[model samples]
Structures are given as structure tokens and as C-alpha cells.
Target: MKIALIAHDEKKKDMIQFTTAYSPILKSHQLYATGTTGALISKKTGLPVHKVKSGPLGGDQQIGAKVANNEIDIVIFFKDPLTAQPHEPDISALMRLCDVYLIPLATNMATAEVMVKGLEHGDLSWREIVKEQEGNDI
Candidate 1:
């Protein structure tokens, strides 16, 4: 499975913690993240992560493009609901793409934890079927 990790500045610490806790399960999959978050995750967990630009610098859109291409199966975005984001439109577009692609998305820690565990237990194997079907359409 391909998983994308993203977080607001306020939630970067939480994202780090989540990645660290799930490193064992996560290491087996391809990981992608926005700039700073990807660097921190790689440095702290020693897990290989493909890094894109910072979210405000178009990383969110980059990931959304992959989602639209059916290249990413899961997205874990730690949003800071209370704070205002300068790139709110980009974030909204990313979430919408996840919906459009039927890709699983977790916007908070609680949902992310459940999704990660589900990923470990093969609950998301349906993604492969979706990908296969997408290929057939092309």
C-alpha cells in the first residue's frame, strides 16, 4: 500500500508520534509526505519516505494529483481545526480528491489509529481491487 502523511504545523509533533508508534507496520509500505513532515519522520523513525514540497508550497496538490492517478491508497492528514490555514483551498481540494478516488483518509489521530490497524489486518485490501479496475478502464 502507498500512504501519504501530512500535518499542519501545530500537529507535526503528533504526526511524529503516530509515525513512530506505527513504524514497524509502516516500514513495509511506501510512505510519502510533505517536506518538513517527511524529513522529520525519516530522521526520527528511520523509515524511508518520499518527500514532496511543503504543503503550503504545493505538496498537498502534489499528493492530490497522485490520489487522482490512483497511486495512493491511504492519506493521514493531521489538521489543526482551530487554526486558520493560508492554503485552505489546497487542503480542501486534497480531501475532495480522496473522496473522488474513494481513497481512505484520516484527518485526526483517532481515525488514523484505526486505519493503521486496519491496514495491518488487511482491511484495506479492497484498494487493490479498485486499482485493478482503474487499470482496466485505461
Candidate 2:
């Protein structure tokens, strides 16, 4: 499965810790992240992550397009709600696309933990099922 990892500046530390703890499970899947977050994760966990632009510089939009195209199966976005983001519209659009595409999304640590465990336990096997069906349809 293709999974996206995004974190706000304030949440990068938590994201790093979470990724570190889940590196074994994560290494089995394709991972992507916004620029600085990707760099940091790669440095800390040694997991290869496809890096896109910084969020304010259009990273969220890029991921949104992937979601629309069915290229992304899961999204783990750690947003800092207490801070105001200049590119709030892009964030909203990315989130809305996740809903529209039926992608699994985690916006907080608690939900993220569940999603990670679900991934590890084959609870997210439906992503593969859906992909297989799509391939058959074509």
C-alpha cells in the first residue's frame, strides 16, 4: 500500500517517534511525506520516503492529486490545530479528497496508532482487495 506521512512543524517530533516505533511495519510499504518531514524521517528511521514539496509550498495538493488518482491508500497527517496555517485551503482540499476517495486517514496520534496497527494486522487488506477488483475491471 502507498501511505502518506505528513506533519506540521510542531508535530514533527511526534511523527518521528511514531515512525521510529513502527518502522518495521512501515518498511514493507511505500511511504511518502512532505519535504522536511520526509528528510527527517529518512534520517531517523532509514526508511525510504518519497518526498514532495513543503505543505505551504504545495505538498498537500500533490498528495491530494495522488489520492484522486487512487495512487494513495492511506494518509497519516499530524496537523497542529493550535497553529494557524497559511495554506489552510490546501489542507482542507487534501482532507476532502481523502473523504471523497474513501482513503483511510489519521489526523491525530490516537487514530494514527489504530491505523498503524490495522496495517500491521492485515486489517487494511481491503485496500488490496479493492485494487485487485479495479485491475479485474480493466
Candidate 3:
């Protein structure tokens, strides 16, 4: 499964901790993340992640494109709702794209924990089929 991770500036620490806790489960899959968050996670968990530009610099849209193309199966975006974001529109569009693509998204730590636990178990096996099909040539 391909998983995309993103965290607002204020939530980056929590994202790091969450990924660290779930690194074993996450290690079996490909990971993608925005610039700073990806660097931070890599530092903390040593997980290889494809890093894109910072979100305000269009990283969210990059992930959104992957979701639209069915290249990503899940998204864990730790957003701080209490704080305003300069790139709120991009964030909103990314969420909308996730919905449009029928992908699972976790916007908070609690929901992210549930999804990660599901992945740790066998509940996300369906993603393997999707990934296999995606790898096959017609």
C-alpha cells in the first residue's frame, strides 16, 4: 500500500511520535510525505519517504494528484483545526480529492491510530490487491 502523510507545523511532533509508534507496520509499505514532515519522520523513525515540496508550496496538491490517480491508498493528515492555515484551500482540496478517490483519510491522531492499527492487523489487505493491479501492465 502507498500511504501519504502530512502534518501541519504545530502537529509535526505528534505526527513524528505517531509514526514512530507505528513504524513497524508502516515499514512494509511505501510512504510519501511533504518536505519538512518527511524529513522529521525520517530522522525520528528512519523510514524512507518520498518527499515533495512543502504543503504551502504545493505539496498537498502533489499528494492530491496521486490520490486522484489512485496511486495512494491511504492518507494521514494531522491538521491543527484550531489554528488557521495560510493554505487552507489547498488542504480542503486535498481532503476533497481523497473523498473523490474513495481513499481512507485520517485528519487527527485518534483516527490515525485506528487506521494504523487496522493496517497492523490484516484489515488493510484489500490495498494489496489494488496495488497489484496498479503494477500490472495491460
Candidate 4:
């Protein structure tokens, strides 16, 4: 599975800790993330990650494109709701793309934990087939 990770400036530390805790499970899959977050995670977890530009500089859109194309199966976006973002529209678009693509997205630590746990348990194995069959049914 391909997973994309993103974290707002204020939530980067949480993202790092989350990635560290789940690095073993995550090591089996391909990982992609925005610049600073990716660097931080890679440094701490030693997990290889494809890094894109910073979020405000089009990183979110890059990840959004992957999600739209079904190239990413999961997205863990740790957003800081208390702080206003300068690139709010990009963030919103990323979340919207995840919904449109039917990809699992976590916008906070609690939800990210659920998603990561599901990943660890292999609960998402049927996602692709289910999405395909649902499309045919429709």
C-alpha cells in the first residue's frame, strides 16, 4: 500500500511521534510526505519517504493528485485546527480529494491512530476490490 503523510507546522511533532510508534508497520509500505514533515519523520524513524515541496508551496496538491489517481491508499494529515493556515484552500482541497477518491484520511491524532491501527491489522486489504466492485455496482 502507498501512504501519504502530512502535518501542519504545529502538529509536526505529533506526526513524528506517531510515525515513530508505527514505523514497523509502515516499513512494509511505500511512504510519501511533504518536505519538512517527511524529513523529520525520515530522520527519526529511518523510513524512506518520498518528499515533496512544503505544503504551502504545492506539496498538498502533489499528494492530492496521487490520491485522485488512486495511487495512495491512505492519508494521515495531522492538521492543527487551533492555528489558522495561510494555505487553507490547499489543505481543504487535499481533504476533498481524499473523500472523492475514497481513501482513508485522518485529520487528527486520534483518527490517525485508528487508521494506523487498521493498517497494522490489515483491515484495509479489501479497500481496492471493494471500491472497484462498488463502482461496477453503481
| lDDT (CA) per prediction | 0.97, 0.96, 0.93, 0.91
Q: Which 10 residues in a row give candidate 1 its minimum summed lDDT?
A: 129-138
Please give the lDDT score at residue 4 for candidate 2.
Answer: 99
Runs with alpha carbons beyond 4 Å of true place in candidate 3: 130-138
Q: Identify the leading candidate in terms of lDDT.
A: 1
Pitting candidate 1 against candidate 4, the one with the higher TM-score is 1
RMSD of 2: 0.8
lDDT of 3 by residue, 67-105 (tens): 998888899999999999999999999999988767999
CA error at residue 134 for candidate 3, angstroms? 7.8
Query: lDDT at 127 for candidate 3?
Result: 73
TM per prediction: 0.98, 0.97, 0.92, 0.92
Query: How far does residue 109 in candidate 4 sit from its true spot (Å)?
Result: 1.2
What are the per-residue Cα lDDT tens digits for candidate 4 across 1-138?
A: 899999999999999999999898999999999999999999999999999999999999999998887788999999998999999999999999988878899988899889878888989998778667867976
lDDT of 2 by residue, 1-138 (tens): 999999999999999999999999999999999999999999999999999999999999999999998999999999999999999999999999999989999998899999999999999999889988988999
Ranking by lDDT: 1, 2, 3, 4
Is 2 or 4 the stronger prediction by TM-score?
Answer: 2
User: Residue by residue across 1-138, what tens digits does model 1's lDDT show?
Assistant: 999999999999999999999999999999999999999999999999999999999999999999998889999999999999999999999999999889999999999999999999999999998878878988
